[model samples]
Target chain A: MMDSLAAVLYLILFPGFVFLLVFGLFCEWVDRKVYARLQNRVGPPLFQPFADLIKLLGKEDIIPKNVDSILFQYTPLIAFAAVMTPIIFIPIWSATALFPLQGDLIIALYLLSIPALALFVIGWSSVSLYPLLGGFRAATMLFGYEVPFILACLSCGIIAGSWRISDITAYLEMYPASMLIVIPGFVIALLALEAKLERTPFDIPQAETEIVGGVLTEYSGKKLAVMRLMDDIRMVVGSSLIAAVFLGGFIVSYGSISWAGTDLTNVINFLLYIAKSLMIVFLLAVIRTLFARIRIDQMLDFSWKYLAMGGIFQLFIAVMYIGILHG
Target chain B: MDLLKWARMKSPWICHFNTGGCNACDIEVVAVLTPRFDVERFGVLLKGSPRHADVLVVTGPVTQQSEARLKRVYEQMAEPKFVLAVGVCTCSGGVFHGCYNARGGVDTVIPVDVYIGGCPPRPSEIIDGVVHVLNKIAGGGLAEKSSVNEGQAVQ
Candidate 1:
């Protein structure tokens, strides 16, 4: 009974729904602040995203006529669930996650893709011309990013010789020098993750100037709020996923310090996760600030020509490095 | 104040619309979003979609061509929305006051919550108008919807 209670707490509290929610908003604040500073402007306060969410919650929910009411009402919830489920597998404050299943890396990546699919459904079901166009663009862009992102991530698992994220992290921790071998994979993963998150340069599906918010043009009030939250949490998940695979996920081990019956190492590990994840967020913000939005054709061409080739090359390097280390 | 009201005041996603006046006010409106002015510090984002907007920042004189479009955009906004009329053109139609194509002001079509009047209001003046609306929202002063077609006809 006690074990079950603790399990439920872990799933609902720390490193779970509440924590990810707050952390996701915090990461967004950091992104906005950094993006603002890059442009020599002051950004919104730390509480800005929180305030926006609250305001959105209180606003009227508008569903357009001639749309599938059921799908329109539920797509945001579906995306939110898909984004949140991966948090269980992410090693947050420890080397192992709350639920560590074998081959969980693939599962997490697959789950992450659901939000994009949900977005496509949102655009298509809206039945409006712009949303339909946005939906097609979203699906097109997903094809551009998903292959390279998955390959880049799998290359790290290949190097660590484990399909589980925690094991790959532990392998990197055990052999810190092996970090050098994953640099190409790290760079590839970072860029592909940026595309997956739909930041600038890859934000064609929802480019405000071109498509008036693209897939989100019709969403308003609470539904839009949920969609925004999903995006924010996806940012947190994407960045941390990259951080874990390439940057040695949550370097602190369990029980490193047991002081007066209190294990503070978990706290330390949580802090480390914050630092690494924020670092990834910072890089993402810089990329977002530096690049202009590219056309869809250009995005696809870049993804196919450069990003995919980079992922393949990185995978080859990881394989060759592992062979050298063992053989 | 409650959290919802506080959030509404803090983040006002604005959508800009140009009626049929000269482009000077529009230039100043765009300038307010630039690095020098940077209204984003107050969490005022210039959103493209009316559905995503909490504030409609209307500029230029309301011409016959744009009055209907303006009303449509205003109606599309989610509830608890505010309209901010900037420039003399939006407030009184300015030089286009008696012109055939001009409809006098934004208030002739949809209700306006705030009006910042200048030949072409400075960016600072535009910012002030936004802050005025934010203060009104925080103070629980709901925007008054004026009756449409109240502007005097051009003779």
Candidate 2:
């Protein structure tokens, strides 16, 4: 009973709700700062995201007359919960996750996809024109990206010889040199993940310039705040998943650097994990800032043509390499 | 309550609404968002949806066709919203005053919190106007007026 209680507390406090929320907002600030510097403009202060959240929360929650009240009001919370669930299974400070399971990688993938599904539901339930269009676009983008994203993950699983994320991390720790071979698949997956997060170049679903806030057009007040926070958390989840799979999941014991003793390794590893994920988030922001939003057809064509083909090629290479080595 | 007010003041997302005049004031409003002026430094984002906006930066004199839309947009915004009427046209219809189909100014449609007057106000003036609105939000300028309006409506 004590163990279960402790697990619940850990899930809600340390590596779970509070930690992810704060770290996610920190990552958002870093992204905004880098984006502003890239554009040669003075950006928001460090607490800008937090301030925005507070203001949104303080605003009056408005529900339009044409909408399904129940679904429209509840989906943001569902989306936020969906994104938060995966953080528990991701090994942040150590090889073993707080809620480790044998096939949690597949579970994490499904959980990660829930936010997009929830978004579709939110848009559909609104019964508004822009949101309906945004819902259709989000669904189409999902179809375009999910195939390549899965193939990329499958390639990593094949190379590491395990579907369990903890096992993959262990294998990578044993053979750190294999990260070079995994880079191609990682790059393909990273681009797909960026589209999944709905950033620029692939932000067809929420093209604010054309669709007028897209799926989020009808959301206001606390719902909007929750949605924005969910997006930020999703960014952290995507980056952390990529970092765990490809960058050797929180193994901060670099050669000959024994400055910290064993007791402090957990804290150091946690910071290292956050740093690695922030680096990925920064790269994503730089890519987003450098590119303009692409048309839906152009986005579909690029994803289906280049990214899908690249993912398959990477998968094929991984299969051949693994078969030869095992045989 | 104080923290909420501070947060609202710190990050004021503005939604630009053009009623019916020439495109000059609209262009200037967009210029404030450009890299040169970059109102984002003050945490000002040009929100696409009225639902997400905290401040409505209105341009142009109200036309008969757009007057209702302007009111609807203002009503759609969340509470604690402020309206900044930009350009002389939005303030008092400018040269379009007394023209057929002109509704004079934004205040004829919805209450305005700040007035920025120029044929087409420069981006700097627009920025100053936004800062003034931020002050009003922080210093309770609108609070007193809203209370008075509430009392009058009750009577």
Candidate 3:
């Protein structure tokens, strides 16, 4: 009974909803701060994302008469729920996930894609000209990024000889030297993840200047808050997933010194996870800061021509490395 | 309530709309977003859509053609929205006053909360206007007046 109770608390609190929300906002703050500093401007405070969300929640939610009311109302909630599930599969404070499965890697990847799909759905349902265009653009951009992202992730799984994320991390821990083989895949994954995030350079789907808010043009108040939070949470999930699959997961040692009824190793591993994820966020911010928004065709061409090829190259390298290792 | 108020004050994403005038005021408004007078520190993002905006920054005089569009834009913004009429043109038509196409200030079409009086207000002045709105938001009095936005246009 106590075990079940602890599990419930674990799922709802730590390494779960609350943690994801706070950490996601923190990552957003770091991204904004870095982006602002790069432009030689003062950035927002740590509480900016939270404040924006809260403020948005307090404002009026206007559902346009022209919109497909049902889909428009439910899309943000659907996207938020979709983005939330993937983080649970990620190994956070430990080397293993809370509920490790044989093919959780693929499951998590597919779950992440749902948010983008949700965006497309909402855009179409908005029935406005900009949103229709935005929806089409989002669907088009997904094809450009998703293939390379999936291939890059699969290459890491290939090296580990397992489809499980924890197993891949375990493999990396076992052969720390083999980290070199995954570097190309990791870079490709990072770039593809950036595209998936719909940030600058790949933000053609919601290019503010060109198409207003694009997919998010008609969203306002509580729904808009939820969507913004969804994006922020998606960033956290994507970065942590990358950190786990590529950066040897969290380095948790067996020495469990219980301090104040909590394992010291858990705390150490949590901080390590945070640090690694923040590093990814920082890199993303730099990319966001340096690049201008690229045209949709350019993004598509670049992703297929360069990122996909790079992912294929990484897959080849991983296969060769594994063959040498067993021989 | 305090937290809600604080959030509302801190994060005021503005959407800029030009009713009709020369593009000088628009240029100055854009300058406020640049590094020289960054308003982002206060969580002010210059949004593109009125739907995503908490504050509407109106530039230029209300021209005959833009009056309907201006009203539509203002109505599109979610509630708890504030409008800052930037430049003398937006405040009271400036040099464009009595022109056949110009219909006077933004308030002639839609209710305006704050008025920045300059032919083309400097970025510093624009930032000052935003700060004034933020301060009013802090007091919790301005939001209540949004619905009754008549003869309440504070200069």
Candidate 4:
């Protein structure tokens, strides 16, 4: 009964959350397409990521003779499930989410963190020197990116006057201009998330060529497949969270779905959430094509120096916003 | 066009070996995959292990220290593999050609099929050279036309 209830709520939070479950392929497709065009070369058809996933899945699971069987098998699911948990707490539209409990911002923030912990576990449990280094890099990255991300979230909370996501939307409704004011804050938050996502210009922790897919090097077959999908869903969830928090979550009531005079506002909200998430995913992919991965020092310097500076300045702006509005 | 289509579909997987050159070419080789110049669309991909590769893309001027790693990678690659010496440093060891640490031209270590002939050839030219190797594999111009050169290139 609880499982069924959760299913209905998941459907309610965003009609398109399932779409994000498949979003990694979309990001992959976008990266391939954009990169191809950048070189004046023809890019792959948009469905390339889907093709790759199927191929990877169909591959035989190969375990090295000396490997730890249990950790090797379970690591990918941990990565996927840990990342997916945050999706349940994030509101897609006004007063809507997979679980719709209040204080969701707190819940969502903590849930968003588990994937990093899981990644470290995977890296360490594999018992390889390269992944161990990659895992350490992942831990270092967590320390560098999370502070600025939390501050950016706090600035939004300051603007909205509550830790609740629903309240953030309501504050935006009361003063739609609050959306415009949070621009710098939103950008810093997005970059910090990008760094966490480990896209190029910030992919120092898992340099594939140098470390052989980093923490994922020994992961193969079903395990590797799940981990890859987790990455895709992570992008989806991250993008959706950004939209819910800053881009007017579920504010648009696109033609309603009604049953017996009760409007399924939840369903409408879901579509809105998906649309917003896809836009962010597309922008990320397009940006990915144009940039190369930066060195480790450069990545750390970028987050600590520019991205962090932007977050601090934006926090200052948020303070001035409260002064002007309430004072 | 038929020949080009076949060449495109069977684009050989490239294995990169650093023979002790500075990391500039190494970075450019990787830059080939960034959103700007995706080589994967052409069916060219990098293989981490040499055993699975069809072509060996050698960078650097073949320093004595790196020579052992390079030779190991070359020996691991399957038969009929093409050797592409990228950058002037690999072909004729540019500035570092005369350095005591430099072995001068990758050919001093392994037989080179095509020399890309640039400080660092544009990714497009790298693609060109890579595709050229595929052509030779399929019995194209150089394979059909050049000397069945038997001299050990290292000498």
Question: Quick one: best DockQ, which candidate?
Answer: 1
lDDT of model number 4: 0.71
Query: Which of 3 and 4 is the better model by TM-score?
Result: 3
DockQ of each: 0.90, 0.82, 0.86, 0.10
Candidate 4: Cα lDDT at A200: 75
lDDT of 3 by residue, B96-148 (tens): 77787787677767767888998788899999999988888888766444343
* Runs in model 4 lying further than 4 Å from the true structure: A1-18, A93-95, A253-271, B1-39, B42-44, B47-155
- Find the candidate with the highest TM-score and give its number: 1
Model 1 achieves a DockQ score of 0.90
True contacts kept of 3: 0.95
Which stretches of model 3 miss by more than 4 angstroms? A253-263, B143-155
Clashing pairs in 4: A14-A270, A15-A270, A24-A232, A35-B35, A93-A250, A289-B35
Question: Candidate 2 — which pairs collide?
Answer: none
Ten residues in sequence with the least summed lDDT for candidate 4 chain B:
B145-154
lDDT of each: 0.88, 0.87, 0.88, 0.71
Error of 4 at A204 (Å): 0.3
Tens-digit lDDT string for candidate 1 (A34-115): 9999999988899999999999999999998889999999989999999988878778778887788999999999999998
| Cα displacement (Å) at residue A136, model 2 | 0.5
Runs in model 1 deviating more than 4 A are: A258-262, B143-145, B149-151
TM-score of chain A of each: 0.97, 0.96, 0.96, 0.86
Write candidate 2's Cα lDDT for A200-312 as tens digits.
Answer: 98999899888999999999999999999999999999888888888873485434234545466677678778888988998898989989999888988999999999999
